[model samples]
Target: DTAVSQTPKYLVTQMGNDKSIKCEQNLGHDTMYWYKQDSKKFLKIMFSYNNKELIINETVPNRFSPKSPDKAHLNLHINSLELGDSAVYFCASSQVAGGLADTQYFGPGTRLTVL
Candidate 1:
């Protein structure tokens, strides 16, 4: 079973198209997240949701939205996808921090290319 899973390992589209990446965690984790790794390999936290607590990192664009219907799933929807939005999107999860550091487990990754 996949701890965290995302579909469409790769995506290619025009500059103004819209797309979405779906995520799910079978680990029964209470927290799930979305991260984007740019061409420079800089992994940045985009959005985090745990029990309805949504923590969004400021650097993420307004055109990007994260939807979490339950504790085990978080999906990312991009609007008016621009060339700059082209990057590797990763879905991650943690059991919820209570004692030690949270180790985010990542999915295979979805490479979105805006051509």
Candidate 2:
């Protein structure tokens, strides 16, 4: 069974369009994170949620937003997507121990193509 999963594994959209990616975890973790991997495969943290509360918000543009309805779900919403937004978005969940994340489980990733 997949512990972490994301919907619409592949996303193709035009520039300026808005999109959203849904993620869920069954591991019962209190913390969830969103990471963006650019074409060069450089992964950067975008957002983090702990028990449905925003804990860490990276320097991403305001157009990008992370929403968590509950502890098991973390969703990413992008408004007015740009060409630079074309990349793979990954969702991960982990249990924080001693102020650090432990044994993170990552989703398959959602590839967004902006043309």
Best by TM-score: 1
Q: TM-score for model 1? A: 0.93
Kindly state the number of residue pairs that clash in model 1: 0
lDDT of 2 by residue, 1-115 (tens): 9999998899999999999999999998888989999989998888888865675555799999998888889999999999999999999988882134378789999999999
Best by lDDT: 2
lDDT of 1 at 103: 78
TM-score of each: 0.93, 0.92
Candidate 1's C-alpha runs over 4 A off are 97-100
The reply for model 2, stretches above 4 Å from the true place, is: 97-101
Compared with the true structure, all predictions reach lDDT values of 0.87, 0.89
Candidate 1 lDDT by residue in tens digits, 1-114:
888999889999998888889999999888888889999999888888888888888988889999887777899999998988989999989886422277788899999999
Q: In order, how many clashes per candidate? A: 0, 0
